[model samples]
Target: MKEKQFTTRAVHAGERADFSQINSVVTPIYPSVGYTFADSHELDAVLGGEQPGYVYSPRYANPTVAALETAVANLESAEAAIALPSGMAAVHLALLGAGVRAGSHVVVAADIYGATYSLVQGIFTELGATVHLVDVLDLKKIEAILAQEKVSALLVETISNPLMKVADLPKLAELAHVHHAKLLVDNTFCSPYLCNPLTFGADMVIHSATKFIGGHGDVMAGLVATSAELKAEMVRLNKLLGSSLGPFEAWLAHRGLKTLPLRMRQQCQNALHIASWLQTHPKISQVNYAFLPSHPQFELMNQLTNGKGGGAVFSFEVRGAGKPEIFALMDALELIQPATSLGDIYSLTLYPAISSHRSLTPAERHKLGIGDGLLRLSAGIEDVADIQADLAQALNKIGHGFDG
Candidate 1:
């Protein structure tokens, strides 16, 4: 079969719509729990793995979930895919399947999502893996870590959460291959529509699909896309750990995925518009969006972003404004939602230090360059002028020595 373009792939791939039965034009939700076999030989084949068949129970495998996996794998252009209960579950399953053993060592980027950081620092470390936090932007620092540490795997996000920093995937992939370590990229921020990490030599790509794939703040799911060999391992680990996503959630993710290309591009446009407006606002501090010319790594961002934009998520410091002042501004905003999670159609904002990375100590946060007054914004598909006006109003009303 010929490879389809991005728009065609997004809408047509894995869309096994049944148009004849009940005249349904979309993929049907297979709300089944068990499958009936024809004879003893079929049952034996399923048990022995001689043939591919669904058996035992629905939690392990369901038709609806299978469609979701196919849809996600197609989006990522990977050999196979799996749907987990949540994005974090996909991360855990991907790591475990990649042979992250008790004595294994991992090199995690410093600007990783806070929950991901805690996972590496607390859980992975406790499990005997020596997790090294790396400054991904500093190639020399990454090289130093790779040379000294016995890194079995290197993990980082395409765009680091809150920080909105982009990792040099090609450089990192080369380094990982040289050191015989698997390169894992969390592509939750810039989905396949923006960049394909595998094309750039990444070994594994994982996502908290709940963000982009769900696209509407309604579902919680995760997806791991990789080579056939790695996907087989992930499947084994997923079944062993019972991290499979529910059928309904998988269906929701698949439903949302069909509109992914349209939604992401719109969100990207809106984000750039808002980010540019914020840069000129006197009350705003430093906005860390790659789309803006003032960004330190604008050149590098252009290379990774492919002109699609700096993604819908970004962060900005409120200068001398403290946590209380920041909270007041966030709460006063009528259009923007003051909540956790992003990639939804509605604008969502959160204080990183207290919300996303609350587990990190003050020293650790300072080391990672996250500030108490920093605000992370997930720009949505709302009208740019309307959103800007609300933010402007909020900043104006709160006058607690607010960064002006």
Candidate 2:
């Protein structure tokens, strides 16, 4: 048989077609927290890793969660995958599983998600790991850092949060491998539909399944895809930390995966349309969408995403505005919700200064080009014209300046 297409696999992968007891078309949510053993022999065999069956605890593995993990692993072309309670949990486990420890050296991208920056700078640093944050686009600087320090893992995002900068995954992976370091990618922005970091030589791929994977915004989950050996370590760590995904959330994430290909396609179309329109608006200072030809990494994005239009989220700077004006614009929006989350069925917008990047100091945000007027928009599967109307009216509200 020929290899199935992405959409086909998305719908059918990890499905057990040969179920005997009441075959349901959809995968049923196995809410059982623990699986029973036939006898003591079976339990011992399963516990000792001599048999192929689920253990007594959901933390070790739940049938529903396992199905979701398998589906994501198949999509990512990874050896195995582990599902967790949240994105940050996946990040913490990935770093720890990839051998990041006290007194270890790690390299990370400067323009990463704010929470990620906090985790590395605060938690990891407190644990005695020295993290070198650099602009990943600057190959020379990365090389200099690698030359100076024995790095454990080179962490980066496929498409940076808010800023939408595209990382050169293949090149970064090569650099990491040469220095005996692993390349760990946070693939939440791109998702498996847009990009697969493992295919490009990443040692591990992390996703905030809460965002794109759980497209409806109802469920919160995270996933880490890696080689079998690393996956075992992640699973062990997840079990020990008690951060495994609940069966219900795992089922929701799996259902969300079925429509990922469709959702992602529409999202890319909507983002391109909205980004192009925003660029022409006089009130907009700069747009940070890679699909725009004017973007710095346009070519790289095209090459990496295979012309998928830079996923669904982008950030743009509002001209002549500060926090007050930006707040007014958000308040005036009727269609686009002023929320902190992304990749939902409804269009959403967030203010980076007070939301995603609020962890950083004002000076630090300024250094990273995240200004008070910068707004990150997550284009939803809405009518392009309607989305534009909402954005235009909001911009108009801020155009005349805040009267109060």
Candidate 3:
């Protein structure tokens, strides 16, 4: 048979044959913490990696989590994938799996998620790894840093958070390979439905399944897709670190993946419409969405995303407004929810200053162009007109004060 389309794979890729008595269409959740071995010989073989079978502990692998891993791996075109408890766990394990050890040097994008920034600066640095945080948009600067440092890995986001800066993944991958460094991309923002970094030469693709992959914002999970060798290494580290995802959450994430292509398409459409509307509004000073022509990486985004537009998220600045006005605007919204997590069925807005990037100091945030007036919008599957109306009314409140 010919290769199945993306939507088809999203729906059926990792499902097993319906051999049970019930013969359900959906993969049933296996919540058992332990699986009994058939015999001692089988247990030993499985533990020693000589055979393919489950052992006693869920940490080794749960059927549901393995299904999630397989589905994500197929989506990413990776040799294998491992599901974790959260996105941070996946990032940490991916770095370690990619050979980031004590005394190793790594290069990370300066404008990444705040928790990621803290991970490198606070945790990895303490482990004896030297980290160089640079503006990844400037290839010259990255090359300069690579020349001076013996880096083990180059980490960056597929589409940066809040700022919506799209990285040139292929170029970065080339640079990392030339420097004998592995390229690790945080694909949480774009998701595999929108962009697969591994297909563009990234050594590993990481996702916070808590967001797009889960779709509903209920499950907290993460995934790392990579070469088979790295997958093994990450699984080993995952076992040692005890970062295995629960069977229930993994099942939920798997259920979410079945509709990822559908949800992502609607979300992307909504984002494009809302972003375009915001761009023309006098109350908005700037809109940062890769699909917008004004975006510095618009052409690159088109090429990378296959002209589908940026993913579901974009950020815009309220004209002449400070934190007070931004808060009032968020409070005035009737439909759009004021929240932190994204990729839900309902439109949600987040303030980077207080939420995703709050770990960064004020000076650091300002340097990265994440101003107090900037608000990140995660467009949902709602009718574009209704979403636009909510935003317009909120902006009006910002103009006339909260009382009006």
Candidate 4:
């Protein structure tokens, strides 16, 4: 069909376009543990990597996962994609596959997921690689950092969790390429629907498919998108490390993929509405959705959100609040779940200082700008008014026990 468009390919690629296996439009999961080979020649070809087909264990490459990877890769316009058990696996594979070695320098943003920050700072740092943290938006500082250090790769989120900082993908890509360093964009926050880092010259794109790509928060999965050469290395390392996404999780992820477009659009709209309302709310100290006019990155967001709202996550500081007040408001919510993870059908909220980013030292938190009183909101499918009502009630009773 000469299909080259994002939506078209997402629905068609890495799958039997007809999906007539059972007269279903969505791709069906192949739950078999292993595939039966027609003959030894065929089996040899499959094992030898001579042809693309499954013959052995499903974990190596399940039809469902292949379909999911193909769809995501096509949507992101990448050469190949790898699906893993969780987002951490995806990040680990990308860093490992990029050929990071002892004495290599890895550059990361300070405002990363808490676990990831620990992994890079705690493990990779000990393994002989140097870690450099910078605000991804600070091009001047990034340039200076790159100029001073021989960085192996640059890693950042497309739109960061809680913070909603949008990286300048094109500029970062140029900077990386100039220094022979690779750029890996963690697309967990925005996913392919909002931004494809590959289209901007990023060497790789990582996703904790556990987030928006899975849509329903029903499964934990990770994905790596990169060039063919990179994919081969990742696959090799993935197999060696004994980290593979299970067949069932792969199936669930495939199902998740089918509705990513629809889910993301709705969530994006809901988040914008919520962020806008929160900005004007008297109880809010700061609203951080990129689409918000008050956001420092509003102009950049307009240029990069592709006319879509920044994918549904943002942080709002509680006005006149310390840790106790923030906790009170979070606990007061009725509909919104006071949760840690984000990107789901149901709304979720958390305080990074106490939740995800708590592990970091005070100095680290200071550098990352993770405030103690911050309340992050993950807008969901609920009506914006309902979400606001939950928050209003929560806020109403926040200072009720004492004084405002």
Residues 1-404, model 1: lDDT tens digits: 87889999898776555545575667778765666667889989887899888774445688788888887778787888878888888888878877788888898888799888888888899988988888878888878878887778899998888887888889999998898889999999998778778878888899888898889999999988888899888877667777778788888999999998888888888888888888887767788886787877676667876877778898988767877888888889999999779999998999998988999987888788888778999988888888888888998888766555
Candidate 1: residue 236 lDDT (0-100) = 72
lDDT digits (tens) for residues 49-72 of candidate 3: 999877744698888788889999
Question: Candidate 4: where is the Cα deviation over 4 Å?
Answer: 1-24, 400-404
Candidate 4 — what's its lDDT? 0.83
Cα deviation at 314, candidate 2, in Å, is 0.6
Tell me the deviation in Å of residue 394 in model 4: 0.6
How large is the C-alpha RMSD of every model relative to the true structure?
8.5, 8.5, 8.5, 8.4
Assess each prediction's global lDDT (C-alpha) against the native: 0.84, 0.90, 0.89, 0.83
TM-score of each: 0.92, 0.94, 0.93, 0.91
Best by lDDT: 2
Give the worst 10-residue stretch by lDDT in candidate 2.
395-404
User: What is the lDDT, from 0 to 100, of the residue 38 in candidate 4?
Assistant: 68
Cα shift from native, residue 130, model 3 (Å): 1.1
Each model's total of backbone clashes:
0, 0, 0, 0
Evaluate model 3: give its TM-score.
Answer: 0.93
Better of 1 and 4 by TM-score: 1
Output the TM-score of candidate 4: 0.91
Check candidate 3 and list the clashing pairs. none
Per TM-score, the best of the predicted structures is 2
